[model samples]
Target: MSDSSDGIAGIPHPNPLRRLTLDQLRRRTSVKWREYPEDVLPLWVAEMDVTLAEPVVRAVTDALALGDTGYPHGTGYAEALSGFAHRRWGWDGLAVARTKAVPDVMTGIVELMRLLTGPGDAVVVNSPVYPPFYPFLGDLDRRVVEAPLGPEGRLDLDAIEDAFHRETAGGRRTALLLCNPQNPTGTVHTAEELTAVAALADRYGARVVADEIHAPLTAPDATFVPYLSVPGGENGFSLMSASKGWNLAGLKAALAIAGPAAAADLARLPGEVVDGPSHLCVIAHTTALREGVDWLDALLAGLDENRRLLTKLLAERLPAVRYRPSQATYLAWLDCRDLGLGDDPAAAFLERGRVALNGGLPFGTGGAGHVRLNLATSPEILTEAVDRMATG
Candidate 1:
């Protein structure tokens, strides 16, 4: 609203973060746009409001132009992601030999769970987590065990070990589905924490399945340690994708990297599991990871500004809505308990302010009275969404 140009709410972002205006974003039929009415701003989902990186767009369009639409071949996605990890996070342990292409991160998780656990077995998850962890693991007939985060939303190592002990008791096979740079809360687990987890999993004999889709979006102030790079982490599985960083979600491609000791299990995956991967997705995701560094950097900068901007906005207009600007990803976990809006503040925001945010209740455990806000949008839109929440 200020049009001050120097910054918005003290977050310096002179470059236009998103190329599209609300009118343009509204024209799309994606879930983020179509989920709510025209008047409502949907900042709930992880979808970015920005356009695709230039290389990704070029790769897709070039493939279409050549009429090269067909099933994917080779381990290009694996190689691409391995290279990305080495360059992006200084993790050089990934080899194409230990990677596999899956339809997406969720698909990879299910397949990995199948390899590690059986039906009716237990799977440990950090609470106030990504909602799909419940249904996805449930579909596998695996039991869901909670290891809720600590009071400050950081990993509760004691709670994790306690859950691992409970779940693995009596030789019951189980897996730990970890969210590094965790979802909703966006607390990037320190390398020390991750190493502790790896050791605990080893001691308890439970496999670790890390869903690190948000690995690349970590803020400059934070460090993202690739699980496999740590000692004892060699037994875990890390799933990653360019879908979040490059806005390639519609293109279905994801990679599951196995540590040295877990390669055999990944190799045991059924062949048919690879059927859902799209060739176009592989090309786009690969191109983005391999060549879209500039665009990705710009996007991260914008996201950094948006995260800071939201902090200032809440402090000024809606101080009651407790928020912590995320260190990774574009999500802001807002503690709305002080608003006295009950367990599901999202509903009230939708009904009253016409702003749609992710409901905290579904995240389970600590989720009640919390809402996860997406900050991957234009500054004006972010301002409008928060303003709507204040009034709503």
Candidate 2:
């Protein structure tokens, strides 16, 4: 089959990929839809509004039909990602022998961080990042050092170097948690920027752990360079999955890849950690990696269309609200500082516009005058959302 969200141009469904409808979607139980009352339009969560890729549904359904559920097994999870990396990102060094299956991306990230740091240690992160990064690391007794992003939304290397130096000043080893195609901002890190980061990490003796879960949702034309694929990255760890890309968070399966030098650290992880991934989740993600490419292409197309629609809707309706089209993922970071919505723009939007959005304050430092809007929905809903914000 060719790369398409639907195998064919047109198909029958309660929610066809290209033409998503909220009427058909509110029937579900995802947090995005269920978090608020019917009167409130939900646009806060990272998941999409499109129907599941046909292949993913089939894989999970067939497993349940045959009662194939059990403890996770085999190297299929790693092998699937390896093959996907080769075909999708053109990186082929993913050896199944060097890979391990984790229950989810966040779980894998914390575990890898443990291998590099201990209690009271620090981790350098670009501010206004994924909200969970703070608490997740905090749960492990790790402190976070902010290396705030520049106004243009790109990596601030000087700030990163300063933070890295400060973290290591205590003679304590730290880990650099990188969110490639950075969350909230959707700024795809250039190969040059990443290489410089790697060099900096090497100089400071800090380990690098990249949460690359959003790598698959990258736009068709925007190049996504895998963190471990660049120089000085041979020892960095990469966390990836089909969960975010395919909207399979409930399945809970992810892969953790180690660069050649870091492969030995894989042995440091407790064997019981492998018990995290559900057996069926493995089957679903493996199927997505191997067979869900076409469906993914279609989803990307849908997101691209929604992002463009948001751009026009903002320009015409709420010109005061500044939004930069994301280079990757369906999440849009809005610079609402100009909207006169006070320190917390999201609160104003929810109270006046009846729309739900992620508050920027919780994301740290640079997030004070911003809000995160999920664009993974039908254009009809998107246009209405903008209009509500405009008239409110």
Model 2 CA lDDT for position 104 = 85
In candidate 2, which residue pairs clash? 5-298
Predictions in order: lDDT: 0.87, 0.86
Candidate 2, position 346, lDDT: 90
lDDT of 1: 0.87
Q: Candidate 2 lDDT (Cα, whole model)?
A: 0.86
Q: What does the lDDT read for residue 127 in candidate 2?
A: 87
Off by over 4 Å in 2: 1-20
Q: Could you tell me the lDDT of residue 91 within candidate 2? A: 92
The C-alpha TM-scores of every prediction are: 0.95, 0.96
Clashes of 1: 0
lDDT of 2 by residue, 127-194 (tens): 88998999999999999989999989899999999988988986898889999879988888999999
